[model samples]
Every structure is written in structure tokens, then in C-alpha cells.
Target: MKLVVRVKLLPTPVQAAALEATLHACNQAATWAAGVAFEENARRPLELRKHAYAEVRVRWGLGAQAAQHAIKKSCDAYTTLKANLRNGRYGRPGTKRHARASGKPVVFRPEAAQPYDDRMLSWQHQARTVSIWTTAGRLKGVRFTGQAEQVEVLAAHRQGESDLVCQGGKWFLIATCEIPEGDLNTHPDGFLGVDLGIVNIAATSDGARHCGRRINRKREQDRKLRSKLQKKNTKSAKRRAKKYAGKEARRAKDINHKISKRIVAEAERTGRGIALETLTGIRERARLRKPQRTTLHSWPFAQLGSFIAYKAKRAGVPVVYVDPAYTSQECSKCHHIARGNRPAQAVFSCRVCGFVEHADHNASHNIAHRGWYVWVCGAQSTAPGLTLIA
Candidate 1:
């Protein structure tokens, strides 16, 4: 499994200036290369490099490797743009949104992230410092800090390119670490179903609920603040809004991480596999009122699911996805499906069996049952000579 470990860089004022200049020069060179590629219709890296390499080195005063990276970055930007266009991310071909994206050459910001290969950047884990190339000169002894475990992982398993990122005037290097996965757990005692919702972020079949009330309140407050700032439209207000732009997102990500870690730990301890809903195209199919739409769209259910998946993989815990259709309305006791089963957001009542339970909890039970059925069927199909009875 590949994981990213980020370390904060603490550069001296002189080193910072050099890094800043290098970033600006590289981005300018990349922007120029992209323009050249757009005009000549050269999308391939090698083809664009042929046209932009020499000019980049001479115009930007970059070294051989830096010049190559700059040209490659430009080509990568165009490749990503082309992919997004084909995927209909910007809109249909004749739409104004699509034209706005496809009409112009890609431009790179001055502080855009730049990739550093081994030859251009070297790390000294023992000293917690790095040496990197710059337009001014080769910079040495730039200090960095990170969590103890993260630093250890970076020292042991780091590989490939590291990206130099500047965010909110802080410098960070995102290093890729390739970690080995544990042996797979083929046999599981049972599946621990997780039901995702807007009100409660996650509800486990074991009757555990990771509530999102606090986080949602915090997000609502932030949204109101941002709305006020936008209405003001002053320079200071805009700066404040920019400063707080990702605060809620970071909080949500941290919450998801904690929730996933706990869930994976519990499942592993009990020797149980994790079951989750296959929620693809959920937003497209969901219908909600104006007030509820914001809450629905802002919730990070996908992030929570992905976090659970990767953590489970690391722990050798099996994971399965089950169909989510009618899970909420179906009664876990009698399997009666009806729209009237859910009288409230939090209550589940089966008219046929007179069974009552929490809506999310009942849904999780259904998910676990379906997951068990799927697992048994799959196991039977795979092992024809061996028989396992449910």
C-alpha cells in the first residue's frame, strides 16, 4: 500500500527566498511551455520537451533536471485537463463551462507544487534536514519536522518523487511511502456492518454511533461566517475567508480518521470483516429539500468509507460492499419492506412484525445479513470441492 507522509519544512529566511524564487521561475517556465504546447498541439511529454527544454534552461536558468521537470509538469497539466474534459467534468462540449476550460492554455500559479527527484533533492533522516536544488543555488540544511511515527516511516519506506508544496505560506514536502500489507484474513467470524448517514456519520451493527452533530454545527457556523465575509467583499474580509477556507474540511478529515481507526480496530479484535454500502451515484439519485441539500452534499461519506477500507486492509481485515437499496426501509427482524417503516429520521418501525429499532441500527443489521449472504455465495462458488454451511 502507498501512503503519503507530509513533513513541515523550516527554512531560514535566505533559504526560503531561494525556494520561493525557484518555484516562481519553474512555474513561469511551465506556463510558457504550456502555451507553446497548446499552440503546436503537442500533448506528449517527449514532443513538448523537444520544443521547450532548451528554451526553459536558457530562459529560467534552471539545471538539467529542473528544466526537465518543468517541461514534464506542463505536459502533465495538459494531460489532466484533457482527461477532465473527456470525463465531462467541466460540462458538455458546446457548453460555456467546457469552452472556458478548453479554450485557453493551462497556467501554473507561482506557488504551485513542484516535484523533486532523487537527483534534485536528498534527505538526511538522522539530522532531520534536506538538501534541494534552487534557482539561486543548491540549498542545504533545510530543517523539517513531523510526527515521530511518520518520520520513521518516511525514513524506512519512502520512495519515488516528493512534492514541494506551499500552503498558507507554510512549506511542506509530501513524501510517498510504500508500506507492506498484512496477510489477508480469508475466514471471518462475521461482518460488522457500517451504515453511513448525514445525521450520524457512521453507525456500526454493534450499536456504535459516531455522531456528526458537533461537526455539522461547526460547519454551519463556518458557512455563515464565510457568507458574511463574502457579502462584505472587502480585501480584509476576503483574506480572512481564504485563511479559514479549509478549516472545516480539515476537522472533518481528522474526525473520519479517528472514526475509521476505531472501527477497524474493533473489527480486527473480534475477527470480523467490515461491510459497507455500495453508494456510487448516491448524490445523483438522492432528492432533498433546499435546506437539506447543503447538508447532504457537504458530508464526507466517501472519505469515511475509503479510510475504513485502507485501515482494514492494513490490519488484514476483510471488507465487503453490499447493495444499499431498501436497507433503511426493510425490517431486520421480519424482512418486511415498506416506505412507511421509517416514521421519523431516527425511528424504524415494521408494520408487519411490530418490530421497533433505531433506523440506522436496523439498516446496519440488514447490511450485515446481506454481506454474509454474499460472502457465503462467493465462497461456495470459489471452492467447489469444499462445503461450508451457513
Candidate 2:
């Protein structure tokens, strides 16, 4: 079990400039590589585009590793765009604008150049410090540290593993350390089920539920602010809009981290295996509904599930993803299935058997029951006090 923790880096103006320069250079290299591929495809063949990149890199004097990184990143972007074009995931490539249109083009940061031990530092000291290299000298300086910030070094990469990324600027790297996996302990008899939803962040079988808390309020406020900002069309309004957008993103991510930590702690206390719903093809299904589209899209189901899985693995607890079909519609008590079973959003009442419970709790119970079935089948362990409803 392994985890990567990210902390912020506070760089001096000079260091910031250098870092930005590196990013710009990488992006330029990627753009050039893409152009070469496109030109070669017109004259020769698409399959021979690799040679075009090699020729471009040589002309540009890019080092072997840097050129390789840039080419690979560009190729990946091209592949994704091609797939999206073929699958109709987005409007035809030329007709619609997407993130790649405005985003800083692909940038490569390889392990060899970004050494872990060489850059590692304590969060307290590192948060304020930036690394800068010049022709004649190097300098490090402390800038500012926010209340929620930390710093540390990340581990060097291993072959065949993609580097961990902090998308949307929510996380920063602090330091890297090696801890013994033996420190984690597991209990075979315990089991826990986690239910993810849009209204509530998560509900567990252990009688603990993490509400969305301020997320709904924040989203509403952000939406109103954005609408107001758009109407103004002033520089100050634009600045405010950017600031609020970043703040809202950070707030949501912080809440997610807290909820995930709480779930992991509960599993540790109960010594239980963790269970979750397998949410495959959920996004596609969500897109089909027009009225409930916002609510469906807002569900952080994947993020919550991923956080729980990694945290549980690090704690040496086994995690299972069971079939999610009918988990919400079926009655947890007698396995009765009907649309009328859930008379309302929050309240669940079984029409067939007259069983009533909270909708989330019922779903969680179903998930837990599924896990229990798996446990029983695998280990043949049964307790005297527990009763199987079916």
C-alpha cells in the first residue's frame, strides 16, 4: 500500500519565473512536435509521425529525455482527441472549444531532473521556500504560507507507473518518506459499507454519515457570483471571478479529504472490510436525464470511491466494489423491488413488506449485506447471533 502526499511550494519571484519558463518551454516543444506530426501525416503517413517528432527535436536541440517526454505527452493528447472524435464524447474536434484550447499545453517533469531527496524539505520550512538556479548562483526564499498549506518532497517515479498529479490546483507536493507497510493492521471479521450520493457526501453502514455540509451552499453562492461577474464585464469582476473559482475548488477538495479520512478512521476502529458500489457507466447514464442533470453531474462518486480505496489499502483493509444495480430500489430487509419502495427521496418504505428506513441507510445495509454474502461464501464463517433475512 502506497500513498503520495502533496504540499505547496512557495517560490521567490525569480524561482517562479524560472519554473514558468520551464513550463513554457515544455509546452512549446509539445506544440512543435504536434505540428511536425500533422505535416508528416499529410505528405507521408500517420503511422510514420514518430520520425517527424524525432526530426523536429533534433532541429530544436532538445535533450533525449526531454524530447521523449514532450513527444509522448503530445501523442497522448492527440490519441485522446482522436478517440473523443470517434466516440462522439464531445462535439466534432473543430466545432467545439474544450479545456485543451485554453490550457497550458503538455509539460513534462521527469524524475531524473526532479530528484526527490535533493528537493525534499520539512513542510514548515519548505512552504515558504522556493528553489532557483542561475548561471552564477542559486537562491531559496520563503514567500507566504496559508492556514491550510503544507510542503514536502514527492518520491521519484518507478517504471511503468504514471506520476501522481494534483489536477485543478487543489494539492501541492511537500516531502517524500518511506514508511514500513507492516505498521498497518487488519481485522478479518469486521466489514463496512460506504454509500455515495449527491446530497450527502457519504453514508457508512457503521451509522456514520458525512453530509455535503457547506458544499451545496458554496456552489449556490459561487453560481450567483459567477452570474453577477459575467454581467459586469469589468476587470475587477473578472479578478473576483477567478479568485472565487479557486477558493470554491479548494473548499470542495478540503471537505473531500476530511470525509475520506473519517471513513478510513472508522474502518480502522471497527477492523472491518470496506465495501462500495461499482459506479461504471454512471456518467453516460447521468447525461441522459435533463431535469436531474445538475444533481447527477455534481455527484463526486468517483473521487470519494477512489479516496476510500487508497486509504483502505494503506490501512491493510480489504475493499470491495459490488454491483450497484437495484441497491437503491430494492428493500434492504426482504429484497423487495419496486419503484414505490422509495416513496420519497430521503424516506424509503417498502410497499411489499412495509419496511421503512432512511434511503441512504437502507442502501448502505444492502451494500453491507452483499459484502456479508461474499464473506460467507469465501470463508464459511457464521456467527450465532446474526440472522440472514433471505
Candidate 3:
């Protein structure tokens, strides 16, 4: 399995200036290359290099490797744009958004992240320092810091390229590391069902509820602050808004990480597989009132699921996705399905069996049962060698 370890860099003022200059030059070169690719209809890195490589080196005063990376970056941007367009992310072909995106050449920001291969960047794990190539020259002894586990991973299993990013005026290098997977648990005793919701972030079949009230309150405050700042429309207000741009996202990500870690650990300790709902088109399917739409859209349910998956993978715990249709309204005890079963957001009462339980918890139990059935069916199929999770 591959993971990214992001470490903060503490560079001197001079070093920072050099890095800023290097980023600006590289991005300018990349933007020019993208324009060339757009005009020439070149999508591949090799093809773009043929048209722009030499010019990029000479025009931007970039070295051979830096020029190649710049060209590759441009090609990668085009590839991403193509994928987004193909998936209808920008809208239909005749729509304004789609036409605007398809008609214009891609542009790179001045401080956009740049990739550094082994030749362009090297690290000293013991010293917690890095030496990297720059437009000014080769800059060395730039200090960095990260968690102990991340540092250890970087020292032992770091591989491939690192990206140099400038966010909120702070420098960070995201290094890739290859970690070996644990042995798979093929014979799981049962499945630990987890139900994700807006009120309670997650509810497990084991009767654990990770509440979202505090986090949601904080998010609402941040949203209100941002709205006020935007309404002010002053330069200082804009700066403040920029400072808080990703604050809510960072908080949500941290919460998701902690929740996923706990969920995975519990599943591994109990020798059970993790079962989650297949929420692929949840946003499209969900209908919400005006007041609740923001909360529904802002919830990071997909991110939480992904975190659980990767953590489970690292722990060799099996994970299965089950259909989420009518899980909440269905009774976990008597298997009675009715629209009136859920009386409130948090209450579930079975009209047929007189069963009462927390809505999310009942749903999780149903998910667990479905997951077990799915696993059994798959195992007994003609292809008995098929594994649920690997």
C-alpha cells in the first residue's frame, strides 16, 4: 500500500525566496507549455516535450530535469481537465461552463505545487533536513518536521516523487511511502456495520455513536464568519477569509481520521469485517430542505468511508459495501420495512414488531446482516476462490 507523508519545512528567508521564485518560474513555463499543448492538441508528456521542452528550458532558464517536469505538469493538467469534462463535471458540452473550460488554455498558479524526483530532491532523515533544486541554485539544509511515525516511514519506505507546496505561506513537502500490507483475514467471524449520518457522524452496530453536534456547530460558526467577511468585501476581510479558507475542511479531516482509526482498530480487535453503505450517488438521491442542504452537502461521508477503507486495508481487516436503500426505515429486529418506522431523525419504531431503537443504530444492524449475507453468497458461488476484500 502507498501513503503520503506531509512534513512541514522550516526554510530560511533566503531559501523561501528562492523557492517562491522557482515556483513562479516553473508555473509560468508550465502555463506556456499548456497553451502550446492546447494549440497543438498534444496530450502526452512525450508529445508535449517535443513541442515545448527546449523552449521551456531556454525561456524559463530551467535545467533539463526541471523543464521536463514543467512540461509533464502541463500535460497532466490537460489530462485531468479531459477527465473532468468527460465525466460532465463542468456541465454538458453546450453549457457555458463546459464551453468556457474547453475553449481556454489551462493556467497554473504562481505558487502551484511542483513535483521533485530523486535527482531534484534528497532528504537526510537523521538531520531532518532536505536539499532540493531551485532556480537560484541547489538549496541545501532546509529543515523539516513531521510526526515520529511519518518520519520513520519516510526513512524506511519513502519512494518516488515529492511535491513542494506553499499553503497559507507555509511550506510543506508531501513524500510518498510504500508500506507493506498485513496478512488478510479471510475468515471473519462477523461484520461490524457502520452507518454514516449528518446528525451523528457514524453509528456502529456495536452501539457506538460518534456524534457530530460539536463539529457541526463549529462548522456553522466558520461558515457564518466567512459569509460576513465576504459581505464586507474589504481587502482585510478578503485576507481574513483566505486565512480561514480550509479551516473547516482541516477540522473535518482530523475528525474523520480519528473516527476511522478507532473504527478500524475495533474491527481488527473483534476479528470482524467492516461493512459500509454504497453511497455512490447519495448527493443526487438525497432530498433536503433549504436550511439543511448546506449541512448535507458539506458532510464528508465519502471521505470517512475512504479513511475507513485504507485503515482497514493496512490492518488486514475485510471491508464490504452493502446497498443502503431503506436501511433506516427497515426494522433490524423483525425485518419490517415501512416509511413510518422512523418517527424522527434519531428515533426508530417498528410499526409491525413494536421494536424501538436509535435510527442510525438500527440501520447499522441491518447493514451488518446484509454484509454477512453478501459474503456468504459470494463465498458459496461457483467461483469459491473469490475473496471479499484483499
Candidate number with greatest TM-score: 3
Global local distance difference test of model 3: 0.89
Q: Rank the candidates by lDDT, best first.
A: 3, 1, 2
**For model 2, the run of ten residues with the poorest summed lDDT:** 381-390
lDDT of 1 by residue, 255-346 (tens): 88899899999999999888889878889878888877898898788877878887787788888888999999999999999999999999
lDDT of 2 by residue, 4-54 (tens): 434444555665555445445555666666665555542223343446556
lDDT of 3 by residue, 1-390 (tens): 777888999999999999999999999999999999999999789999999999999988999999999999999998899999999999999999999999999999999999999999999989999999999999999999988987887899888999899998999998877777767788999999999988899999999999988888888898899999999999999999998889888888888989998999999999998889988999898898887789989988887888888788778888888899999999999999999999999999999999999999999999999989887776321111111111
Decide which is better by lDDT, 1 or 2: 1
A best-first ranking of the candidates according to their TM-score comes to: 3, 1, 2
Question: Which stretch of 10 consecutive residues in model 1 shows the poorest summed lDDT?
Answer: 381-390
- The lDDT per prediction is 0.88, 0.58, 0.89
> After superposition, which runs of candidate 1 have C-alpha atoms over 4 Å from their true positions?
377-390
lDDT of 3 at 313: 79
TM-score of each: 0.95, 0.71, 0.96
For residue 316, what is the lDDT in candidate 3? 86
